[model samples]
Target: MMTTMIRVVLPAHLRTLARVESEVRLDVPLDAEGRLTQRAILDALEARYPMLRGTIRDHVTQQRRSFLRFFACAEDLSLEPPDAPLPDAVASGAEPFFVVGAIAGG
Candidate 1:
């Protein structure tokens, strides 16, 4: 199995929960087809920071939380499928995957 070092930037609240002050670095394993997806990243993240399990995604369904959004290379990836491959920049650690807290209506 091939692994890639992915850089993930978490929101302040989640950073506090995970006791991390800056961006997180995770070693994520690529799928059989050599694809690096959000699921792979999140799985590695949760495994390293168990406290963030339900904060980013539902514990049971493993779905993204409604109040959060995903972005990479200035593009919104929240609507993308979990199994979809991420941008090469993200996979190559050139760009960080951002987990931003969504802002709501006033």
Candidate 2:
């Protein structure tokens, strides 16, 4: 069976840190069925982009890092559960999964 693929865009720093040239590609399971979560996707992403092992979440605790954020459809999903269903564009493979860094300085 062939699963749909999704394009995920990482922060510039992460991309450079991960040493990836282009966006990351993820394989959506056949039965995902609108369950656009970040955990599985993140896992798959890390598996593919080994250099990004601990960019989003911690390697040991698996908890989201300090300033990492997940966004889609112009909404912030950093607080959303990793297994939560993301926007249709993301699930449908139209948009890209974004892992951005949060900056808090005035």
Best by lDDT: 1
Where does the lowest 10-residue lDDT sum fall in candidate 2?
28-37
Give per-residue CA lDDT, model 1, range 1-106, as digits (tens): 9999989999998899999989999999999988889999999999999999999999999889999999999999999999999999999999999999988763
What residue runs in model 2 are displaced by over 4 Å at the alpha carbon? Answer: 30-34
How many residue pairs collide in each prediction? 0, 2
| lDDT digits (tens) for residues 37-66 of candidate 2 | 677788778887788887689999999998
Candidate 2: what lDDT?
A: 0.78
TM-score of each: 0.95, 0.83
lDDT of 2 at 16: 85
